[model samples]
Target: MEKVKESEAIEIDIPLETSLKKKLQQTPRWETFEPFALSRVPYIIRENNKELYEPKVVSIGPYHRGKESLRAMEEHKPRCLIDFLGRNPEIQIEVYVEEVKKLEARARRCYCETINLNTNEFVEMLLLDGCFILDLFFKVRAREPHTLLDVGWGAKTIIADLLLLENQIPFFVVEKLHAIVTHYEGDRDSLLYLLQPSSVSPDLPAKGNIYHLLHLYYQWFVPGRTSKQRSRRYSGILISTEHSRSNPIVSWLNSRSSRSNKKPYKPMRAIPCATELREAGVIFKRKESPSDVFDITFENGVMEIPMLPIDSIRRIIYMNFAAFERSNSAMEHDLMSYVALMDSLINSNRDVIILQQCGIINNMLLNEEELAVFFNQLGDWSTLDSDKHYFAWLFAEVELYCDSRWHKYRAKLMRDYFNNPWSALSVIAAVILLIFAAVQAVYSMYPYVHH
Candidate 1:
């Protein structure tokens, strides 16, 4: 029998093809799609320390709105609402609800995930959460005591929860609710004033530009230098891609020769730890009244770093800030850069002690080892671009200072001979004895010559 001819190849499924085409057409274009400001902490970062990302006591946004563990704080939200409403008695509850309802779509778009709550539910959630936050701010500003917020550890936990990457509603929602409730006519004073501490200027980003509470908090720590200035500073260091790739052998040879010829003043992948740097004659000092925590500087063998107080709550706050920067590419990695710098400087307990003695670190951890571990682990959460980060110049200067051979010799001499008064005295005595012996030998030679 003739080999059975295979049935004609199956024709493409017209309906299925059409369906797929429709799906492809509906899919968002990656080039044009903007990222949501509020998103889950990336798994790469969250896996390192899940507790830092999760809200322990309260949930503000739709992501963690109904969790069983966070529900205990839900009942307290209504109490906050009552307190908020009591602040502005003339404005009815419906006015606030209506305002938030208008903001529902915009607020939902701020979150990366699709919100499951309906219009009514979403509006009410926004109302309660926004009012709760504003009430806390009011309480904090007035220095008034709240039954829950004033209770032991409650304020700290709630503040951390509010700053969580997952637990945030859009700031505009809160701002709108505030305006409706308070009828404040001032341009900058109402919400911005309340959110920031007295020390931070209320002159923040324009109202429409702010994403959420965490974003606002992130803005407060931004380095005084503008991005344009940073770009200018890094402009000279950028090698032309065409020139680098023009000749492989020549490029390799040039790189080798450059390495051999230079004094190694380049940026380091990881700078020496505090102890090692100290041994290299690098002095550490606490930057007094720094503009912000990121204001670190190095000059003439001295590194002035702002004081960093490490505690459980502050660690969580900073970690969340780092996580936010990691997730949102639009944000500058100021906090992450700072963390990376700290991680490089603190490699062990001895390094911690060095920073502590210089008043650079006020570690509240059980031991110096724990603080060191915290920084080391945090460094793993985000990869820093040393050449492009805020601390790039500072790092380069520090490495250049450490690379000085004279500084090393001087440091060695001080450590070996002048480390203590006894050592210094012995050194002085030995030098004097050698000088006397040389003088006596010269006199004896003179007598022989005269004879």
Candidate 2:
């Protein structure tokens, strides 16, 4: 009986060992996973407005590929591929297919999630999507419109869908297809120029390491500062150790002590709204023909902010840009920081009115209340490090100006006594009457003293 039991145990152990070995071989190496620039919208941001992050007109990537509502656009994709091939009669469809097939592995790594499709399916998707995108650009360049695509709201929504974070393929795939079709090296800037809306200035330089379409759009709009520029523009005051340089250890110790003695970092809070700032003597002006929308400046009690156009399409793009910044660690939070600053500046309709009056906000679609709510919600969705944002210096300067008692008193005096022409005239009249009364009293007293 003992010998029979030992044989059965050995038999069971063999299958178990084999199964364990197979599982280990199948397991992915987590450390080998690179950071993915294209990812789904984070739950924290999407919880409030999931629809905003999702593509409404079309699905460009695997994440939202087969939904029933998005199937209508899928049908048009094949037509786009045919149109693209028509333009490049020299190249065959198989050539495009084989080219995208070669890039399947590289393209898969760009997405955050593991795409469940096999090689054939993945390559087909890339080929169709890539050709579709290039076709749109070609048509736009020629000033011709697709019979189905450029009609009604379809064109606008398609542009919005292309900017969605999850709807992006690796930019290299598009560049590869463009190069093959045109038989010339693809200029990324030229390709990106076709994607921009008529409202966005196409002349802006699109220079950067672009991961996808959304990234290219971000680079055009929010060009980040270089390392040296950031270091110089940093709002924090640096401690000089010139005197302690004689002893290395002493310098190190002194630096350490100074750091330890410094106050703990406090998260940056929102600045006062536009109305409140106006009440505090901070002038608001629209920065005329600003080089960049984010180029806001505060000096001599005047705050010059670039005019921001508020509309449904722009709002969608800004939200996606903020979402991209939130998801990707490599991206600077320039857009998010801008949104936060706008949110802080516009707390209510009154705040919106103040900015609107100064030409800082070009209200196109949303009402004052809706715009206020939009910015407030946007600010809530974004996260910022107080000391590291692009606007940290601007925030500090504005707060410093607002904090001064003289500015507040001056503003209060102006507001309370001289807010309007009538009020100024009343103040002047009251002063004149008081002076006359003083003169009359003095004359009366003078006559009595003489007596």
Candidate 3:
């Protein structure tokens, strides 16, 4: 009656392997196909620059495809797809669908987001996006006037949307469609021609390689920037803790070249902008290099910035590139770092003018203040990476030159005595006249001595 004791009952403990087996048997969602290549802009980035991150005109990829605002462009997609298909009257659209079906899994894996689409739906999406992109490149490379080109802002909007990071199909999908449709291996060349059209002939990947459109662009913009993989997919947001915590660009100027880790970083005053540097006798020169556009350098009292062709798409592409870096844990924010460097150089309208006169800034925007604000507001930067010296060294050298009393005095002397071309000529004429007067006075003294 003390009750059939509970101790008499049998205890059944579940085996750990059995639990694991159950978990293993559970249905896997798009997880089995998680891709390391493409991802939407992480919210932290998208939150601050939503306008830039969102597609304004067209959406080529799944990320921004269904937005209400982008609906108008969706109507154009069928037209683009039709034009792309019409180029080869013999090839049915099913041939393109089968090709995309083959790439569907690979393309799906390239996107970090779980594309909740059936194989048929996914393949169709890829084909439509891929054909639209190829059609755009074809129109750009055609060199003949199409009615679309004549349509105001038609060509411009297409070009801009193609550069948006969110608006990209997998490159392999695009390339395969290009080959099947165009009947040649000219996809890469056509894209390079359309994007650069002048100097760049990017050594694009062989068929199966490139990640997406932005990846294609960074390769052209920096030529070898993505030549090597910088981090594993596991690394997560490659920007350093210090960079996010404090503006390292500002920290480096404030820092006193710490030789040891134990030393506390001392913050120095921010370096002067283009105008201030000029007033302190610093020279601004355009660096002509086929290397990275942001390969800024300082030497012999001159700050040489590579000439950046200020174009409409440059801002859009750069914003996407920086966002891509922010989303990936393995990649460094080199694009963001570059923007911070530009921001440091431009503090006001006057600074933009300084760069413009020096041929460093091609102000296609024509509004110096607006351009200055654009650079200033790029990516919510507080400073730059203190440990990294993408431009820290240049800033330090500039700071040293500006701090020199001798440089300041000489700068003042040059400005006061010989600033303009006319001023220099007048000074030379005055010196020659004074020398003649001195000679005449000496001759008069000699004649008096002879008498």
The Cα local distance difference test for each model comes to 0.76, 0.77, 0.68
Q: Which stretches of candidate 2 lie over 4 Å from their true place?
A: 1-24, 30-35, 196-203, 227-267, 435-451
Per lDDT, what order, best first? 2, 1, 3
Q: List the residue pairs that clash in candidate 1.
A: none
Q: Pick the candidate with the highest lDDT.
A: 2
The predicted structure with the larger lDDT, 2 or 3, is: 2
Model 2: per-residue Cα lDDT at residue 182: 76
Q: Which candidate is the best by TM-score?
A: 1
**417: Cα error in model 1, Å:** 1.3
383 in model 1: Cα distance from truth in Å? 2.9
Ordered by TM-score, highest first, the candidates read 1, 2, 3
Model 3: per-residue lDDT, tens digit, 1-451?
A: 3344543442235667887888878645556664555767667757877877677777887888688987877787788888889999999988888778888777877776667888987887888788877777677676655555677977766666777767788877877887887686655765545445345544443233467777766655653333433221111323232332344444443453354333454333357777878888888899886445765666667778887766556666666766666666555556666676687778988898889998887878758877886676565633346445344444545655776799999888788878998988998999999999999999989978999
The C-alpha local distance difference test score for the whole of candidate 3 amounts to: 0.68
lDDT of 2 by residue, 150-268 (tens): 58887778888899988888888998898888776756656666666555565566675678888878876785654114221222443222221233223333454478795433435
Reference-based lDDT, residue 413, model 1: 95
Which of 1 and 3 is ahead in TM-score?
Answer: 1
lDDT of 1 by residue, 146-258 (tens): 98777889988999889988888887788787777777744545678788866554443433367788878877756434522322122134433223223322333346448
Q: List the pairs of residues colliding in candidate 3.
A: 236-329, 237-328, 237-329, 247-383, 247-384, 248-384, 248-386, 249-384, 254-267, 254-268
